[model samples]
Target: MKIFNLPLSESTFEKRAPFYGRLSATIEDMRGKTKLVLRLLLLFVAKHEIEATNWKIIALWGMG
Candidate 1:
């Protein structure tokens, strides 16, 4: 992926440590049930809230 002319490779994405180490660690330490809740919370965003219909909209909304 390219971000502002900076190239980011697949391996960079696979390793979340540099970007989200603390949040990742917190998620990792959660119980199975808690993890499930977290996943649900993350996936439960209302479509209308984001209004993302395509990749471009999704990217713009995500960045904004």
Candidate 2:
């Protein structure tokens, strides 16, 4: 992946720390367990609401 002209290799993506992945995994895993995952979504949204955007990390995952 390329972000801000920086090249990101597969290994770099794979080597991301758990801090970058755990909540995302939790969100995916929670899918289908409940008819409405509003609470889970709220948690995610609320987090992003409070924190500053880290485009480098988001782009590392090909997101944002």
Candidate 3:
């Protein structure tokens, strides 16, 4: 992830298998605890990869 818009690490972009499975678990966890709008906003701002190909990130608070 990027720190102050500076390049961070290459390992951060490493492939993660079964992406949907892990993602589903997280969604279930936040289903009732957090509102949908808030969750979407958080996800949008917290972990944005400006350069998708490079997997560079601009994580603020990160995933819940």
The lDDT for every candidate, in the order shown, is 0.67, 0.67, 0.58
Residue pairs whose backbone atoms clash in candidate 1: none
Tell me the TM-score of each prediction against the true structure: 0.27, 0.26, 0.25
Task: RMSD for all candidates, in order, please.
Answer: 18.6, 21.8, 23.2
Candidate 3 segments exceeding 4 Å error: 1-17, 35-64
Query: What are the per-residue Cα lDDT tens digits for candidate 1 across 1-64?
Result: 7544422777766675465667667677786679798778777765534555566687888999
- Candidate 2: misplaced stretches above 4 Å? 1-36, 53-64
Q: Kindly list the per-residue Cα lDDT of model 2 for residues 1-64, writing each as its tens digit.
A: 7544322786766666464589678777777556367878888898887664665567777953
Q: Ranking under lDDT, best-scoring first?
A: 1, 2, 3
Candidate 2 — which pairs collide? none
lDDT of 1 at 37: 89
4 Cα displacement, candidate 3 (Å):
28
Clash pairs for candidate 3? none
Count of clashing residue pairs in every prediction:
0, 0, 0
* Tens digits of per-residue lDDT for model 3, 1-64: 7534422455443344356468778998887667877888887866564355245333432532
Highest lDDT model number: 1
